[model samples]
Target: MSRVADVKDEARSRLRWFAVHGVVRFFAERGIKIGDPQAKLIADPVTRANPGVVYQEIRDRGKIVKGRVAYLTVDHGLIFDLLRSDDYRTVVVGGNLPKPLRAIERRTRTAALHPLAPPSLLSVEPPSHTRYRKLVSSVFTARAVNAMRDNVQQVADTLLDELVAAGGGTVDIVSSYCAKLPVAVIGDILGVPEADRDKVLEFGELAAPSLDVGLTWSQFREVEQGLEGFDGWLATHIAGLRDNPGDDLMSQLIAASEDGVYLNDRELRATAGLVLAAGFETTVNLLGSGINLLMNNPDQLARLQDDPSLWGTAVDEMLRLESPVQMTARVAKGSVTLEGMDLEAGDLVVCVLAAGNRDPQVFDDADTFDVGRSNANKHLSFSGGRHYCLGAALARAESEVGLRTLFDRFPHLSSAGTGIKRDTRVLHGFRTLPVALGEPATVSA
Candidate 1:
């Protein structure tokens, strides 16, 4: 923690980052020059924002298109199979690098508990994955989520009330409502104090890009700082919970044990941190994308207005049309044949979930966004199998109630400007969504 130690740690982190991603950037840039669609997908911001063309190109190439770095798949069925299969494992940072680079990574591994690191459900496979998942699964079960619905609605209503009180000018919905609502819910669930909710949001924003690949040194440093800060704060918070438990999920997790084996300090921190951050990040994207989609497609909005029951399906449709988490990768555990394509051990497969959601074979008129689309719920947006999003139910509940309440309150909301998109390939959503709240709907007397 001294200045000297800090400098050393920073140097080590930089070395590890370069070992893992610097070569990736170098090849990605070279591949981009050669017009490699996969490289462009990895390196280009424009391609990340509008990936359909590259997805189509990948699909056209084959079921599994080899890229400069890894193989790409946009096929819905193959993605589904790969996600569910035990033959594939989650890709851990520094895991697939060459021996020398991995040696550099091992020596320089930082002490920060990253959301994508082991002990976090995102990074581990079964046995460990099963254990970690089991401890938290009960809290997110359908019954538990349904019990939280009224609270979610109240939170949505409170946020909308604050938005209404901001006069009638343009405001960034991402900050005011979309981001705040889910963060508040997740914060309360994690026993995060109201005063520190903003700090949690700040940490989340800084660390969001940790899910991505090929980050520049500055980006990597920022992400590590965020992770380090969150780790320190979470340790103190967990100690407080241990001393005096509350009704929050984190408190429940603190006391909960499995077969007389309780979670250690590191495991506890990783689980609590992942839940708190992942709890709201994607939902924030889902809400932002939902609002944008509704504004752009008035017919879909009109349909929802006519039949409020369609709100549930409307959220699913939004997730399908504009998936919050764009892509996820899996490394083949061993020799495997997927859809007649051979994959050896450690072969990386980047599943384009957004593209798979738009696969024509899976959904008729896949590009179209229809709230009433009967098969909207079948999309790969939540992913599949064990690594599927733990907060999917809560996200759905929050998005359904949040979007419904927003539009119901401001029935004539309109865009103020083009707005800013979050600059990350893995997570897709608005960073700032400026919208004009036309007028408050008349409430029943």
Candidate 2:
């Protein structure tokens, strides 16, 4: 064929691929049938806000409604069943990597895996998942997180001081406070050097989208580059810790690997990467969302300010009301029945965690944010079953201390600027929250 003819053929092929993968795949992920007129509703922020409406519609249609590309479940009971059952599984990457990314991996032959790289906890099933979970589960237990309370508090205090210093008590809380606290706490937990904490924050945010399925080609490249940079740095640090073990979680995990806990070098890199990356991003979103919730809901904010003891429950309520992780997907492994819907092997099951948290059948005044709600812990913000968040305790501790400190330090805090919401489909939170730390200036005498 002539060169011009070959180029024209390649252009046609590119168009065909985008039509199939880009347009079709995006709609399928949202649980819309190809001919559905209601597809536009999914793109609307007002409609998206109450995922319960879509969830209930899907539930009403069937236990599982098969979209063009995947099956979806929003029924609270079905979601829990799917999460806990071995019948369903997770495919973290889902073939989203661009050709160039795959080519780069083949050429580089690096031992380092992206933090969201497959076979890690977020992607694999047991016995691999079981083995990986066992390696660090003990250290992430409630007891371990409790032991770090003073450190967490100290980090929150230090960040608050910085917040007060910046913008003269008028600050963007997401940057000046929420964004910093989690990384500092997780950094301290993983024994990251003080000098490197800022990089961890930078990399954590950049690499977080690796957890989602909707990456554009450009996004895939950025995610890959960020993961490579962070993972490369992490690999060197991990090697040093392996040789000179310390009291930090990284050293402990490395020591365990040496003592025959059975983690390969690649697994070691992915594990540490996952811990710092996942721990940092989710907790940051949690704190940011929690602050957004309280800022908008003055009554609940007042309740926490008055009692102080309600901070724990208040955090849970925030998680329930504005879950950091709005949705996650699973794949069915075999023929099975779910709430009257039958599924064959290879069916994708998208679980709407945020929707389930708002199911009226589960909680009283499910839509309302009640800090004193007794059942707030039942929220699946940390997920459920074998795939539950490994750092749940640490996330809770960080947010509790962070919130308690912020409110205590600035009881008169109020919104000073329009908050900016993050434009993301998977992780939900504000990108910026501007607040005044003290009472508004009174008239001069």
Tens digits of lDDT, candidate 2, 1-445 = 6999878745643443343234534664464444331342334455455555666676577656766556666667778777888887876453333455444334433344744446577877888888888878856667788898898888887776665556456778888888888888888778899898888777766666665543455555566567778988888888878778778988877766423666877788878888887788788899888877788889998888788888899888888888888888777788987767787777777777887788777888888989999989888888889988888888888889888777777777888888887656678788889988884323234
The prediction achieving the highest lDDT against the true structure is: 1
| lDDT tens per residue, model 1, 1-445 | 6999979977888788889778777788888888787789878777876788899989888878888668899999989888999888998888888899989988988798977779888999989999989988855567877888898998998888777776867899999999999998888788899999898888889989988878888888888889989999999999999999999888888888889888899999999998888888889999999999999999989999999999999999999998999999999999988767788999999999999999999899999989999999988988899998889989999999999989899999999988798988889899999999899997565
Strongest candidate by TM-score: 1
Question: Which residue window of length 10 is worst by lDDT in model 1?
Answer: 137-146
Q: What TM-score against the true fold does each predicted structure earn?
A: 0.97, 0.85
RMSD of each: 1.4, 5.6
Model 2 — which ten-residue stretch has the worst lDDT?
35-44
Residue 187 displacement (Å), model 1: 1.0
Q: What is the lDDT of residue 415 in candidate 2?
A: 86
lDDT of each: 0.88, 0.73
